[model samples]
Target chain A: MKEKRLISRRRAIFTGLTSAGALLLSGCLKKAPPTYGSILRLGDDLTYLAQRGLLSQRALVMEYQQTDITSFPVTDIGDPANPASTKAYSKEYEALLKTDFKDWALTIEGAVAKPGKYTLDQLQKLGERTQITRHSCEEGWSAIAEWTGVPLAALLKDAGVLASARYVSFYGFDKYAESIDMLDALHPQTILAHRMNGESIPARNGAPLRLRVETQVGYKSVKYVQRIVVAEQFVDPAQDIQAGWSWYNGI
Target chain B: MSASQTTHSETFRHKGWVKSAHFVITFAFLALLVSGYVILMSHPRLYWGKAGNDLTPALFELPISKNYHHGGWAKAIPFKNLKGSQVSAARTFDIFNENGWGRSTHFLAAWFLIITGLLYLLAGIFSGHFRRDLAPGRGEFSLKMLWRDLVAHFRKQSSAPGKYGLLQKVTYLSVIFFLFPVVILTGFAMSPAIAANYPFLLIIFFGHQSARTIHFFAAVLLLLFLLVHVVMVIRTGFKRNLWAITFGK
Candidate 1:
């Protein structure tokens, strides 16, 4: 009797699998084509924005100064190091170090024709320009950070961007993985930022290297980037291969 | 068949982890609620998108006949009038900012939930949570299952209990996919670097301000769902249903 009861219970569990709802929702087994695509697909719009456009993009990033170095809003995703997450006032500028970022290099490689690295000096050697760009974030707040970095085009030009280089994506060490497209990559305000608040980029704030893509939003400005790969196509292993992030995240 | 059935200790199940994750999320959520309430006491019934009030207390005699800093509430706690810089206002903001840490704690607990939920989801899938709805001996579909569940639910009968119903599956799947992702994305949409890095995300709901409004709304929805979920669990024979979730191996 116990065994029979268990078997009946088991049968009851998947009771929905055969329901009209599942049959209707699961598009895999149907012969008739879907009248509408999955609503899941629209969720990819932000991913799409992060992936395309150029030339038409604008120069809207802002700039900040040392004296104007006020409080950057405290992030809710507390640093893994300090889980207690003391308020901004209790925040310490612990990663403070003074170094001329002259030797730093921004490497734009992967799926590119001329995969090469450019030093801050070499990048400046290519041609230098600075802009006060607005930093828009998905977080719904905006701040102006004065950034001094090399032009993205200078690096793109050096890479000779292989014919297939479709997406100029960002690489960061923020423990976050985000990217952008060629349009914003080559935007005038878009830069490989080396300085913030008139000083070298601090480690906590994507130091050693960070991109200042001012037009679209902040997440596109990959920080703590050890390298940038100009892919023949925008390929996010974390997105397509892993848990999907929208291919384009332009807002 | 009897021998195939594994003993309790032998099989890895949610016996331990689910309980732990539940406790952590609950604890962190509680902390956030408490901190937020105290801080909001500084500014009762705050508004979104529009300008709102931030009331301060004035020092005076006991019974504390209070005055609204800007507006009034039907029945709000009043404090006596006071003199001097209102240190409590600053303290309130401090705690409000501090509550942001509760979000971090929630995420940490979320990490635990994702790990455990992953196991449950995977095991449920591979172990045929999807297939259990099908009859074991059949190559053909059964309309009987549907008729029975519909009848039972309509008549408010509890005899049809097995694991989860069709509606349960729908709700669970929606929560797992749509609702949860909305919460996560909206949460990220509030970061400065993130906002700067991905302004397009801000553009999705028109701007960051709107995204935040949506995030708050989603939280309220999740809270409502949680309340309903608890009630349903109790309605569906709390201990028996819980035994499956907690100790079923």
Candidate 2:
């Protein structure tokens, strides 16, 4: 009788395990996002889904006081004395820098009803929003800063974003580009920051204009803004996935 | 002879679900440790408070890589409100930065660990595994019993063939009830997206960098536990324990 009971219990355990495995496999098949070559990317999908589920659509990140702002890092900007040290530094950027970006203009064209170009003065006139929020990096560091900018939604509205647009892409003069979905595109906290800590953004920190995506990692906040493109689908920004960074990176 | 045989036959065997969870947790933990180590190799300094970088003073620095104090500290410059803060763009040496796969694997293995751990917790509660096997009885908490176990451990004296000693029970209980949960919570507290939605985690951990520092220490403790656990298993009839866990016999 004892042997029989053991057998039944073992059978039950196997049955339960098999069912659980089947359930997980089916769930992955149905709901898994883009795997980006490796099966481990499914974990990224799980994280994305879990975070989205937990966060309300318009949930705002914790804001800090001006005194709470910390010393923010300037990554990928390289030494100003040696502009060749960084990947983002270019002859064009150097030339623009020489005159304090007097001739630089931001172009908004793709999938917009009104394609146009705007100078710094014009972009600043659209609207102003100042927020002091923590900037979390993928490298396990975080710093709080007060950023002043025009809401991305305001810019999109002014540019007359088309109904078919699903993603908004930001291209930087530094050759870096990133795209965000509609949810983040319209988020009140998302802005094209023109100033940092009450001063015009330093060249080391994306001068003239930079994208502030408060909902995501710091990398999502592209710097040195040069153009904006509204698109139907996300354009993966140059080997970002192949290089093993998550495209969404909401955290 | 017959009585002894009966006692031997009735030796404790781990339950099926317990064995299953243990198997999954072992692999998941190994994955977490390796991937976590790889990720740590990229940036090995631990700090406290809301933010930290190479420029900030570290609470602890691991000597595993060249990333620690690479080329000394950058000179402090006047930042926002603070007078003379270190600039963060002064790294002189490139450390091991191939941590993309590490990050991916770490998250994946973390999911497995969390799911299996939660299931184990529920099963332990529902099946009375925690009560019967892990949790020490009221009488077992006596100092004499603990001292005896400690002395025996020092002398390399093994306990009864399959019984848990008072020391074993306490250690296992602490690991399950405290260490694992702390590690998982600290891990979640480091995520910006999670913190955005649940600021309570940040408050509980004190800050983002604090959470990271705590996570590192907890992981180190867990690794130490794993080392001791393996050594104990090997010393106390490795084949027998392995067979019992694998076959539930």
Candidate 3:
């Protein structure tokens, strides 16, 4: 009787392991967002789906008052103190910085009916919005700051976005790039920020232009933006994915 | 012979589903703790309120690594009302920053833990396991009984085989009902997306940083509970306990 029981127990364990493996394999079969591995990507997909289902598309993130604004620190990767680490910044950026971006122009191209370059002065003339919102980083730190800029949707409309456009990609002068879905691109809070805290954005804080995706993590707000591309397909920022960062960091 | 048969029959204490959930959550918890530590090593400082960073004053700091104030604290400017407590943005040393895998593992493990925990909770309730096995029975909550259990534990006297003592029941109940829920809620509060949808989480926790601080403490408590639980299992009868929970023998 004891031998029979032991054999049955071994069979039960085998069956349990097999079923668990099958379940995991099924999860792997589903297409997921870009992450480090299939398992991690599956987890990201679950989070993305759950958040998308629960959160309102138009719901705004929390906004604080001027008094609530705190000391916003620049990320180490973009630290002006370590210019060598800022791989995207080049000699061209240095020249533009010397003239305070006077010669700089933001190019809007790809999937746009009227692809054109707009100087800083002309871009600001399109529209303007200011908001005090918290910039939450994935590293468990956050800061609140007031940002002033023109809404990205305004820029896209001005460029006459084509019907084929599905994603908006932002490219920095330093070669860093990031993209957002049309939902976030059209978000009222999403803007191409030019000024921070009532002053021209400091060089340490992405200077003349940066994308402010208030609803997502701070990293999604790519700084030093020089070009905007409306894309017909999902534009994957290869660097971020290669570094194992989640493509859709909604939170 | 009759007494031996009765004891043998009672050896199978755990239900099949309970054993499965227990093992799954155990694996997930282990993954979470290790990955959580790796993530924390990247930035070991804790703060209060909505915003905190290298340029802000930290409410609490851990010296696990050189990440804290590597460039030295900022000098106080009396006119500016600065207290010189903020960490300087310039760092003398590079921060520990290999947390990409850690984060992915943490999120993945968290999903497993939540699913398994929810299943265990629903099953425990429906199956009367919480009432019949986990809950303190009549007279079990009495001070005398609790004290007796505590004294017996200190003396390393094993409780009855296949039965939980008063102290065990209370600890299990608190862990299941209070501690796990608090930890999960505080975790959600830290997520910006979740907070955007559920602002009440932020309001309850006082802010993002506060939620992080609370999450850290709750995790520590859970760690302590795990240690004590493993010790108790070993002290009682490692083989018997393992067999009962694993094969439900």
Off by over 4 Å in 2: A1-33, A77-86, B1-11, B72-77, B80-93
Best by DockQ: 2
lDDT of 2 by residue, A1-251 (tens): 34655458778999999999899767755543467667677777787767666677587778887666777767643443246667666677788888989998999988899999999888889999999988877766677888999999998999999998978888887788888878889988999998888778877678889999988878889888888999876576645666687767774
Please state the error at residue B15 of candidate 3 in Å: 0.9
Residue A216 Cα positional deviation in candidate 1, in Å, after optimal superposition:
2.9
Give the better candidate number (2 or 3) by TM-score: 2
TM-score for all predictions? 0.40, 0.87, 0.85
- Which candidate number maximizes lDDT? 2
Model 1 fnat?
0.02
- Off by more than 4 A, model 3: A1-31, A34-37, A76-86, B1-12, B72-93, B142-148
* Angstrom error at residue B56, model 2: 1.4
Comparing 1 and 3 by TM-score, which wins? 3
The full ranking of all candidates by lDDT, starting with the best, is 2, 3, 1
RMSD of each: 17.7, 5.9, 7.4
lDDT of 1 at B249: 57
Q: Score each candidate by Cα lDDT.
A: 0.48, 0.79, 0.78
Per-residue lDDT tens digits of candidate 3, residues B1-249?
Answer: 124323433453799999999999999999999988887777788988887876777998887665755654324222122232222233335567766667767888999999999999999999999999998877668888888999987866656666787888889888999888988998888776777778888888888888888889999999999999997676555677788889854
TM-score of chain A of 1: 0.63
Q: Give the TM-score of candidate 3.
A: 0.85
